[model samples]
Target chain A: MGRVVVDVMPKPEILDPQGKAVAGSLPRLGFGQFVGVRQGKRFELEVEGDVTQEHLDAAREAGVQVLSNPVIEDVVAVYADTAAVQA
Target chain B: MGRVVVDVMPKPEILDPQGKAVAGSLPRLGFGQFVGVRQGKRFELEVEGDVTQEHLDAAREAGVQVLSNPVIEDVVAVYADTAAVQA
Candidate 1:
């Protein structure tokens, strides 16, 4: 089994009202030092068979084409076993 | 600064067309053993200041209220420094 992680974010130029609202609320959330809070979405999937680059690419393409709006969003696909540890 | 990760998934009862399509592509990605690929969305936010439970709670609430469709999706909020490592 393999796992895939997809992250979707609004275009940098786009006005993320949701992000802004969340950023504004950070102070209230006890993150008093936080001045900005940008929010995005994450998706996780478990593949039933062997994991391959082609599968990852196709899955990512599908994400860009159907799961998100290219005009307003950007996506990143990460294959769990091969993904670099986050910094 | 603090980071918040929000994962958004379509409700199990709802049809996740994008996820299904992505799942279908996994075989090509080299994940032949994978039979199911449920896709979700991930969002990462970098707070400019301190991080607190209240900030986390508020951020999570905002995500649920405005960032996602409650009827069609579910969300999970994780505070980076305190988040339990995924198994």
Candidate 2:
């Protein structure tokens, strides 16, 4: 199977409460080295066969159209996971 | 500043309703080539200075200890994003 990885992150200008909660907890948990934390979403899309260009284009479209909200989030990365394609 | 990227995913055996919902929506949205979808989390942890081995180790520890719930999620990747650092 082939896999495509899509990363979606909150826009820099937008507020991220989930990330804030995590950042708030880190210091209390003894991980004070971290100055900030931004939590986002990662998606793996499985394909039946080898991932083609069409699949990548479609995945990018899906990344913006479905996986992320364009108003508050940005599709940061979209690429195929070649290591995931097994013989 | 440097950034460490941590990826967390639902364990294979764990149920992922969000992923299932996305999978179900794909075909209806004309992305039928995708056979499956799995949704997870991506966290960007900011560091005060250059990324060191100590920071990487701490990020990995935080990945498992705080970022993910070992009960149903797995920390899949923890790495530095060299491209994100600015001099």
TM-score of chain B of each: 0.80, 0.93
Model 2 regions more than 4 Å off: A85-87, B85-87
lDDT of 1 by residue, B46-82 (tens): 6545566776775577568755689888874445543
For candidate 1, write residues A5-82 as lDDT tens digits. 666777667788877876676566554544554555565655555557776775576568655699998774444544
Q: Pick the candidate with the highest lDDT.
A: 2
Task: Name the best candidate (by DockQ).
Answer: 2
- DockQ for model 1? 0.32
DockQ of 2: 0.89
lDDT score, candidate 1, position B8: 71
User: Chain A TM-score of model 1 versus the true structure?
Assistant: 0.79
Error of 2 at B62 (Å): 0.4
User: In angstroms, how far off is B1's CA in candidate 1?
Assistant: 8.0
Best by TM-score: 2
DockQ each candidate and list the results. Answer: 0.32, 0.89
For candidate 2, lDDT tens digit of each residue in A1-87? Answer: 999999999998899999999999999999999999999999999998888999999999999999999999999889888764443
TM-score of 2: 0.94
